[model samples]
Target: MEQTETPPPGRRVALAVLGLSAMTIMANATVASSLPGLKRHFADVAGIDTLAGLIVTLPSLAVVITAGLMGWLADRMDRQKLLAFVALCYGLGGTSGLWAESLNAILAGRLLLGVGVAGTMTLGMTWSADLWQGAARARFLGLQGAAISVAGIVFMLTGGALAGLHWRGAFAVYALILPVAVLALLALAPYSRERRRAAPVAKGMARQAGFPWAAFAFVGSLGFVFQAAFYITPTRLPFRLEELGVANPLAVGALMAALVAVSAPVSLAYGRIRRHVSAMSVFGLSFALIGAGFVAHALAQDWHGVLAGSVIAGLGMGLSMPNYTTWFLARVPMAMRGRASGLLTTAFFLGQFASPLVSAPLVAHLGLAGAFGAVGGTLIGLGLLLAVAQIWWPEQARPETAPAAVS
Candidate 1:
């Protein structure tokens, strides 16, 4: 039976896709509350502090390597099946740390977890673009972003409580994602059969145009910078709290949750905002706010300042998430959405993986506060320049609407 080119998302399909989106947050930050304890647990090992930090960010390294490939596969394969398989990988790999006896073992599990992330996130987004266009796409992505932030809030609180019990306990939360694999398979079964008949057409369309490398480089850079700067909150915030004399895992979780909490409303409002301003203008404003938030963190005397920084930065983050995805999708051809989404995912995760590597040395030399100040300063300058450029060169401000998917 021939499947319609792009069916409207039914409840199950929508849930499966959005559920996959939520896991992207759980993929990394679910363990954020445990970072300090993990460091303490592995204190005997040299450079364990840095290695422990990797537990949160290391899946990104795997995503950096595999997201492009996963994207490519999505264009050619049954994305529904692939997404389901990866969800299983996400569950198994994420839970491995729960039983890991050594830091190396845990890191190995993180790499596998990254592979799962590359597939789930990339394919979930590809499905979104496949299923919707224009205003519908924008609205769905906004809802998707909000769902992710809400998941982050839940996972942060859950992880923090788990970490308080035992650092390993936090890893168990990952197992909860196991059911998503079944959900994807059952929800997408009809699409899988329908899409199979359209495979040849998709393949033909894929070769009609060359990949847009230059355009992607610009978009990719935007994603990278946003991630690198934003990751400072998850990767280092716990230690920052420790320095400020708040060491409880639950407290760290609450603060991190607070950071994500504020982003939810901003994400929900993204559709309205996108209608009024260019994506570039939104990026400019978001970056400026994030920079200011970091500055607040740098000057903070207690957790109150951290809370203030989180709220400020969270708003920017909310704007940035939906904006980046929308901007990238606007440029992607329907046939090539998979590969493009994968590459964009890679760019984003590469920034995440690079964050700790870059920040560790900065923290070593400048101290955490000074490091925050320096990064905040750079982002603020860059944000202002982007804003000014958007005003002077309005042509670049307005994004082209995405090419409509073939039916």
Candidate 2:
């Protein structure tokens, strides 16, 4: 028998990774929540309101362009060194909002900020997967999902408080996330690209390397749909509620929070679901529930309709989020993780950025009902493709009887 040493492990690495993951969520959420305040400051500098949302979302475009390239590079380089470099990018890019006086400057800062988010969310996962295995990997993923939710919760709460002090002060809070993420990674060593085994000569390993494509497609499409349905709702809801003679900002915030809150517990419980159900079935169920939520939102005449819809869809996302990421990591060789994940996260972010473009025209032409009705249709299309892909997955994952003859 050939001797193979296990990858590095210690409590320090696990906590560090978890802490890093947790801190990242807060940074992402805080920037988004504090955007309004930042806009007020930048509005004088940039002479724009429509473009304010652009500052926040513009990064996704950059992330889509960069994430895969970086991930592929990570396969051939040191991930921690890359993450450390990006953390500086995060801090510098994030802080630029404080001093940026021109629209162009803000746009440049936004692109950098996008790069930081991409590194933490995508590469961090790859690193952790490289470091852990079996149940621990599953546990860490679950915690990552929960930590992301916690960040959202904390950032929103903190943002509301800090926005009163100054929007710049609010943004300053995001700069802290980069250092914390780096330290946690340094101290904990959560992932293990350093110890990857050589590729085995499996009869169909080359073809097999494509194993996670369908799942990746599903996750990527879902990210875009999530952005469209979840994000567009808040902007549009305020208008729709105005049409109904309700203009209370407090009520709207409460309702939206309730919707997202629905996903947190369900996301944490994902590990339990995996033990009993096939990911294909769960993915289908998630899509169906999300579609139903869209339909409910389309038909909603009152707050109750939207609230009910969000709860249903939140449950779907909560259950499916970590599973999708883990599913991809599990099937690929450690050596290719950076490239593979870069592609996956890029797809996910690209979908997120594309959501508004894809759905806004429909919303404009058809009214909320017609526009959201269109979203349900898109989900059906994605879900159908996934269902078919599921049929082909088992054969692709079968153990290789012989090594591939790669020249």
Give the best candidate by lDDT.
1
**Alpha carbon lDDT at 331, candidate 1:** 62
RMSD after CA superposition, every candidate? 3.7, 4.8
Which lDDT tens digits does candidate 1 get at residues 123-190? 88888877766666677788899999898778767887898899888999888777876787788788
Model 2 CA lDDT for position 97: 65
**TM-score of every model versus the real structure:** 0.88, 0.83
lDDT of 1: 0.82
Residue 364 miss distance in model 1 (angstroms): 4.0
The whole-model lDDT of each prediction reads 0.82, 0.65
Task: Give the worst 10-residue stretch by lDDT in candidate 2.
Answer: 398-407
